[model samples]
Each structure stands twice: as C-alpha cells, then as structure tokens.
Target: MTDPAYQRLGLPVTASPFAVLRAAVRALHPDTRAVRGFRAARKRFYRQMLCAHAARQAAGDRLTG
Candidate 1:
C-alpha cells in the first residue's frame, strides 16, 4: 500500500525513523519560520503524518502502539 504521508514527504515506506523526522522537519520549515502560529500547525500536521506512516509500517506486520 502506498502512503500519502510518504508521497508528500517524497520518501519511501522503508525510510527510517530518523529519515522520517528529518523529512518532516524540512517540509515544515520556512513556513514555520515565516507564519505566525505555524509552528503549532506544523507540529499538528507532523503528528498526523507520523501516525499515517506508523499505520503503513504496521501494515507490513510490524506492530506499533
């Protein structure tokens, strides 16, 4: 299954945790710096992205909580 989270981040399902965090940070940057309240929004968005990624990972038979 292809994940939109990975698609949006231009990454792969096999991407490591470090890679996911880095890509998310990169995507959130600049906007977070220039816009007011953007940091909070970015954090919220990143959480959803991570949750989606986790769901995809779990689909591969790796259990997560």
Candidate 2:
C-alpha cells in the first residue's frame, strides 16, 4: 500500500519524505539569514506541519467511518 504520509505531501514514493518536508518548510520560511536559524525554523515548522496533517487525516477518517 502507498504511504499516507507521502501522499499527504504530494511526493512520489521514490522521494525522501524528509527532503519533501524540508522543501515545504523552506517555502514557508524563505528569508533565513543563517544556517542555524534556518535549521531551527525548519525543524519547528516541520513538526507543526506534521501535527496539523495528522490531525486532519484523523478527522477525515472519523468523518468517513
């Protein structure tokens, strides 16, 4: 079966999920002045996105079931 996580991000099965998530974070926060700051923001943004995605998925499942 296809991974829901990959589908959620609209990435191909062969793509790295971490890379997809990193690109998303970069798109959201595009003005980083330093590597450390970018890394920190990326981590925080990724966590937030993942949590939001999971919540939406769970809610959809609940509605459909």
Candidate 3:
C-alpha cells in the first residue's frame, strides 16, 4: 500500500521508523527564518511530521499483526 505521507516525505511505505523520523526532521527544517507566516509554516511542518509518524506506525502494525 502506498502511503501519502511517505510519498510526501519521498520515502517508501516499508521505511523504518528511524528513517521516517530522520526524513521528517530533514524535511521539516526550514530554509528561511522569515517572521511572516512562520507560525503557519511551523504548524504545517508538525502536522506533516505527525502524519509521517502515523504512517510508520501503521506499517509496523501490518508487519507485526
């Protein structure tokens, strides 16, 4: 199954949890420190990270159960 979160993070659904987290950190790192829209961008980044984490959990569950 193709996970949209993995696709957004440029990872495979079978990726390890550590890999997912590493990718999330790398992806979430902001290129700019602009004060404008910083709050909204931060919120989006956190949301994406959560989605990636959830995808990793779902993948692990499928493997274990």
Q: Relative to the true structure, how large is the alpha-carbon lDDT of every model?
A: 0.72, 0.56, 0.65
lDDT digits (tens) for residues 1-65 of candidate 2 = 33354345664333444666664655563456346647876677677655555565666678889
Pick by lDDT: which candidate is best? Answer: 1
What's the TM-score of each model vs. the native? 0.64, 0.52, 0.47
Q: With candidate 1 superimposed using the best TM-score fit, by how many Å does residue 61's alpha carbon deviate from the native? A: 2.0
Record all residue pairs in model 2 with backbone atoms less than 3 Å apart, i.e. clashing.
none
CA deviation > 4 Å runs, candidate 3: 1-36
By TM-score, who's the top model here? Answer: 1
Which residue pairs in candidate 1 collide?
A: none
Per candidate, the number of residue pairs that clash is 0, 0, 0
> Sort by TM-score, best first: what order?
1, 2, 3
User: How well is each residue in 1-65 modelled by candidate 1, as lDDT tens digits?
Assistant: 55565578976677777787788878765757578767787777777777777777777665543
Instruction: Specify the poorest-scoring 10-residue window by lDDT in model 2.
Output: 5-14
Sort all candidates by lDDT, best to worst.
1, 3, 2
TM-score of 1: 0.64
lDDT of 1 at 2: 53
Ranked by lDDT, the better of candidates 1 and 2 is 1
- Supply the global lDDT for candidate 1: 0.72
Q: Could you tell me the TM-score of candidate 2?
A: 0.52
Model 3 lDDT tens row, 1-65? 54455467776656666776677657654554345668676657656666766767787788899
